[model samples]
Target: MDLFQPSPSAHPGPELPELLPLGPDGIVVRFGRVVSPQLSAAVLAFEQAVQENLPDGVTEVAPSLSSVLVRFDPARGRRDQVLTALRKLLGGVDWLAETLPPASRIWHVPVCFGADQAPDLKTFCQLAGLSSEQAIAQITQTPLRVLAIGFAPGQPYLGYLPPAWDIPRRAALTPQVPAGALVAALRQLVLFNHASPTGWFQIGETAFRPFQRDRTVPFALKSGDSVQFHAIGSAEYSALKNRSDGLGGARYEAGA
Candidate 1:
């Protein structure tokens, strides 16, 4: 059985997407309470639509796990007007049935697992009832879609892992995991953008720096991108770490 499913009933209201006010400068168009692939598709679709037919004075449109945050200049755009425009757009389409937009890029990130880089791998494998080899195979076998980029700069929340990988967060935090740490919990993977403590288990480590201010395009990954984490040897990982390009031995193809 699947461990998680969409729970539209979690909120008591109309089944349609909800538009909630986000301060004077922004509004949130929430699709549903749960974070599912379908809802993500809807959110992205709406995000694309808003970008295509941008409202007057609207400055930014960002998609979260289940919502699209539309920000505007309060001086140029009134809250009521933006809300009305958003409501009309929301009502015009069956967003939930909309197909996911094509990914902008697909990344193949090389990672070194079950060594010093992945300090929590043994425990994570134990929780999933899989041996280290088995765990690695399952994780590397499939490319996870980038659900939403948040919680940190350029950090990508990738999911949904198979049923056996639907593990929960650890009861306590792991003091700190380095930037490029591949952590997992709640059937999702979060590629850390910087060294930070987390409740998620550190399953692997990649040299890919998702956020690098020095580069022309600082954020390496974006929402709707796909990531394939291929296993690499410790030596190869070390080599990638020393390179100056900052991609960490990862390459991408356009229009994934």
Candidate 2:
């Protein structure tokens, strides 16, 4: 299908309403005013299709929360041409859930939340008017999906935290959290792969290194994978850590 044709620039429209250029090499296609999973899924479907087909003059097609950035050479096709291609793809896209790629990953990440392990767990409980156990229970009860991985390499933002779990990031940042730290905010839980400072409520720590440079698959997680963080204590994390290599993975089947 010619993803280069123009249509109405609205939801499900063939023509994108706005096209912003990234210098002379790239263009950002704005699908809507805000980031919605529906829009993200659409963007991803298009991205995957483009990756599989690969258009001429285009080098990269990346999908963010609600927009797609297309990189191409102006010498081969003007910015307009790129937009034409995008419009055609957007128009041709079929957003049925079936068209979306399977997540292909379900990871049971073990975590140690609260106290020294999670400095802000108590605070999150206080803000939510719940006790620590209730908070942990709430977190463990819900399964989260990898929303998008960015703002840092291999760093992922997972979401739709229950309303009771909603809270804003702190005004001040905490010291860098280690790789595998589980944090929550904005209805999202982020699993850190690299040590980076963050303000999201630190709820737990896991040995599951999300990013590993030596491995062929550097990032252990990807957007679309399902995750459930099981709570444990420092000693448990220690036992898991000590025998991690023996287990052969940062994570394994929960019961296994």
Candidate 3:
């Protein structure tokens, strides 16, 4: 895990708990600072290791960008043991590009870039200091790895955007972005699979819903999946939304 260390003041301290009982049934073990790729990798890798070696009593283990939530089944063991086990394992694990958990799936997502449906599209190009085409070229230039899904159900913060593309969140959030809105901010791009408010640059649209209500594996994308966006226009997005003959036309299916 030494390779995951932040330089100088960037270090996020220890992976120790800052508070106990992150909840009544679970605990959150924190690691490093917020939003750093190094720390995020550590968090995910640690979660994977714990899941593989969990003692008999753990009911659930949920991992986020910088924390892991452990839920214990009282029927099996006590929370104390769970915490101790997590600590013992995480303390000894390695988290670096060389040790990443390989992806379970690779999905191709279709997205329509810079159209009226994406109201914030123009604004995003302006903020990035690039022409509309240039912005589209950059965004679709490579596949982004899924980091973690949070904030909204099935909403993923995908990233490792080029350093020059990083930007902070807007001062205010979007009033409400549509379910398929593609939002980008800082070094991450999130697929807004459901209607919600956000401040990330609304740059694209997708036909694949990342969040669904009545199905198994509702999220179309999972952590570690790779995604590339292909551009289309407003007309297609509208057709897809209308459930008309042209549904899915606006988005390109590049394959998973």
Worst ten in a row by lDDT for model 3: 244-253
Indicate which candidate wins on TM-score. Answer: 1
Question: Which regions of candidate 2 deviate over 4 angstroms?
Answer: 1-17, 33-42, 73-79, 92-101, 242-256
Q: For candidate 2, lDDT tens digit of each residue in 1-256?
A: 3333344444362344356778878887666666545665665666666666665689877666666677997678777766766655555445434234555566777778747778788887798788888878877878766767788777777765677767778999988887667888766788777788988878877777676677667777656667777887788887776643322134533311
Assess each prediction's global lDDT (C-alpha) against the native: 0.83, 0.68, 0.67
Ranking by TM-score: 1, 3, 2
Task: Kindly report which residue pairs in candidate 1 clash with one another.
Answer: none
Q: Tens digit of lDDT per residue, candidate 1, span 1-256?
A: 1212213544333355777777768788889998877887898888888988899889999888899999999889887778767766766478898888877788899999947998999998898998999888878987788888888889888877877888888888889999889998777889998999999999899999988899889988877787888999999999999977789999999874
TM-score of 1: 0.88
Compared with the true structure, what per-residue lDDT tens digits does model 3 show for residues 1-256?
2322223343243434332475556777676556677776766777778778986688877777767777888778876667556656654344534245565565655577745556776777677787777777877786677777888888787876767568778999778988777887787788776788887778888776666666464555666666666666666655566643222432333333
Better of 1 and 2 by TM-score: 1
Error of 3 at 88 (Å): 2.6
